[model samples]
Target: MGLAVVSLKKGEGRLLKSGGMWIFDNEIATIMGSFVNGDIVLIHDFDGYPLGKGFINTNSRITVRLLSRNEQTVIDEVFFEKRVRDAWEYRKKVVDTRSCRVIFGEADFFPGLVIDKFSDVLVVQSLALGIDRYKEMIIELLKKVLKEDGIQIRGVYERSDAKVRRQEGMELVKGFIGPEFPTLVEIEENQVKYQVDVKDGQKTGFFLDQKYNRLAIQKLCKNAKVLDCFTHTGSFALNAGIAGASSVLGVDASALAVDQAAANARLNGLEDRVQFLCRNVFELLPELEEKEEKFDVVILDPPAFTKSRSSIKNAVKGYREINLRALKLVREGGFLATCSCSHFMDYELFTQTIGQAARSAHKRLRQVEYRTQAPDHPILWAADESYYLKFYIFQVCSDR
Candidate 1:
């Protein structure tokens, strides 16, 4: 079939005009020519001006995810080779390529795809139906590119079982892209070691986006008591212990995660200094408060409370409750590190929520720094969804 042309309605592609990669179904005026869903299609302005090319999926609200802004661009192995190489090259310059986000979906201009490197293993997630069609080619190309840089990828795993795939008319599935190997992978970051369970662990085995954020809290933990809530795999707690913290307690409700966290503590030789607890943070925080327990540093790294905008109000309440409880536990002049991974909760809303929490806890906050996800998870400006993870560190002072 010839290239299908999708023309946008007058003044309907506002987001696209502003440099976003998505073209909604309602924004389309008409489709000229014939093509199947998940096929490459040309985009045209209402006046017949070429806007570029993208993959169209009628099953999703995001009808078209722009692949290239150049109309002449071809989609093939040659095209994917360049994209994969460019992504790897960018990571080498900006982050530790040993284990980092090699391809960050829209941020890397490969919308609907995410690839993370954990030691020698590659974890790939192809969310959109269009990208799923080329997933194999992209993975092979990425392996070739990394090999040129002296990196031998021992295995490739697919974690494309996200629920969102159904929205694109795709099946939920995950397995090895090639021959299966041990799913458990070991990785080191900020001088701390962890065993990542790629097959059954959280997104991409580990949260590589927080790589440097964990590093930032090291100095604050020296010879101090630390508390790390929602400590999946005990990342922050281990960092504290490695940084000479007197003691560290990591809490997570998941028994599996707690066991992994405890194992990680042992792996880092910090089992004595760093400990793991299986408990609901919401219940434990108040219990600790009643016991008058205080910590020199408290880190709240909760999983996203709300995945959609409709639930953002409840998400705010959750963030506020945790931050307030954490502030009350911070000894006078102590530090608190809190962050939200939800994109639905914008920066302004998150900051405002923290301020409310401070007031309720009667703690005066002195802002030390504001941070986002690590550089490897680049925030593409025009693509707002590419920018999540708002992190902040504050000094908590007793209200006089």
Candidate 2:
């Protein structure tokens, strides 16, 4: 088959030359022919020189997601196997836990694909139409790689609930590929045990990316009061309680999540020290403050507020509001660990939002650490968007 061609405008060569893979709608001079969404396209400069190969999507603002910069290379099954094997090798060497992100989209040279390893199971989410088109090849490589490593390959689950999939003109898909569904899976990270529900739990059944950030808070939890906002399954609260915090409170809006959090605390034998509350975090923060409830350590790991450029400003406001309230509720010399998973909100913007919140709350804040996703979730330097996870741990002091 003749290659579908995408011709770039005059200066767009700069973005590609500088290692950017995304070709926005505005960058295209003209698309040579009609291609189905996720079809491979050969990108060319205005001079008609072959630049790279990418996945085409007529529906999205991002028209092309470049797969390889080498113009001569074909994106075949063997090519995908090589990428998957490289991603797997890096994760096995870097990540200490079995439950970790195996491939983090652009970070692993396979943009729009994320894979999480949970013990014997692998959960995959293909966010881009391009990667979705090659799902079979990717899965085949994953199975082969796991088998070669002597790892028990039990099942593969697909969780493509992300809104990006819709933007890519793909339908949501969730189910198991193997014989049996994993009802419950236990994973240990930072000396804490977590039960994951691969069939229904959020984002591949667990927030494995936050493994390091949760452990950072553990060091400061000795005999201190702790509060975990947006506590999906009580990972933070349980860690605090296990670290000898005097008391730990976990709050989340979902009843199922709250129930699961309570059960998780009990599973870790920390029920006596941890409490779970099912309430909206935006409302609960102020209510807790009005009741004169203060905490020595507070964690706010909310869902992504902005999925695209249009919502970034509003998301910043939401981030500021929650951090402002949380900052006010922290006792003097207390610690605050907050995070945002929105790729649209860059690290500078996110930290600036937190700084603005501290200024408004009349609190003195000193950042103790700036963290990102764990090693397994490697961020490719060439693709900045893959570095979406941002975590900041700060020491709070009253201006008074």
Candidate 3:
């Protein structure tokens, strides 16, 4: 049987033309030829002109994910090897390669796959059925590419438990990809040590995307009393401790996270100065206000409050409330570091929300710095999804 061809409705290929990789299910006018789901298919515009090559998944709302715009480019081991090599090279050029996001899904052109390298370990999160079929081959090629410089990957772990996989008819599951090994892996970044449990940790263990952003707060931490809200595994708090903070208090709702954070503090020999509490940040903020508690530095690194467009309204409210509380808790002329990891919380909107929070808290904010996800997790132009993570640092002061 010949290959399948997907013809998009008129003007439907605009996202692809504009450099995005997904083709929504509703955009296709029709699919011809015999092909099953997850098969490579040719895409054409309404005028019958070839668009590119992509993997078709009838079960997914993303009907097809274009792999290449070049009509003749072949999708094989060689293609995957090149993509991995290029991604690794980019990381080597811009960020610390020891622990970084090697392949960031569509950002690196592997439409539905993400690979994060932590020391000698690799964690994979496969999100699409069409791409799932090629995951093994991709991992092999990734290892091969990494080995060119005598670097060896000890193990590969699959964390393909994202709910999006269910939309593509895949079950939520995670396990070692090859030989079994201990899941708790120790890795160091910016001189901070972390014991990452890939099997149970959030999104491939440690949040590598905030690697540099954590370093950005170091200078402001010397001898300061700092508060870290939503402190998963005590990352920001530990960074502050390592930065010579006088005392650091990290808070999280998860007792497990608090335990891990405390363990991490002990691991780094900062247990004396670094403390963690298992408490909801929202409630703790009000209590701190009641006691007139204040910190010389406050960090709010909350999880994504919004994942979809529809939740943005409520997300905005949540963000504003927490930020307003956080701002009020920061001592006058002290630092406030805040961030939102939700892509749906666009840059403009997140910044605007912060401004509203500052006004509501009756405080003035002097912008100190702005940052985003580390370069290893690069943001590709025209691929809006690649551009998440908006970080801001401000000097808070009483209003005029």
Q: Which ranges of candidate 3 are over 4 A from the true structure? A: none
Model 3 worst lDDT run, 10 consecutive residues: 70-79
Candidate 1: regions farther than 4 A off: none
- TM-score, predicted candidate 3 vs. hidden true structure: 0.99
As a whole number from 0 to 100, the lDDT of residue 311 in candidate 3 is 92
Query: Between prediction 1 and prediction 2, which has the larger lDDT?
Result: 1
Clashes of 1: 0
TM-score head-to-head 1 vs 2, winner: 1
- Which model, 2 or 3, shows the larger TM-score? 3
Q: What's the lDDT for residue 178 in model 3?
A: 94
lDDT of 3: 0.93
- Residues 1-400 of candidate 3 have per-residue lDDT tens digits of 6679999999797889899999999999999999989999999999989989999999988999989987789888888888988998998899998889999999999998999999999999999888899999999998988899788999999999888788998899799999998999988988999898899988788899999999999999999999999999999999999999999999999998899999999999999999999999999999999999999999999999988999999999999999999998999999999999999999999999999999999999999999999998889888889999999999999997
lDDT (10s digit) by residue, model 1, range 1-400: 5799999999888888788999999999999998889999999999989898999999999999999988999888998898888888888898987889999998888989999999999999999988988999899899898888898999999999889999999998899989999999999888898999999998878999888899999989999999999999999999999999999999999999999999999998999999999999999999999999999999999999999999999999999999999999999999999999999999999999999999999999999899999999999888999889999999999888
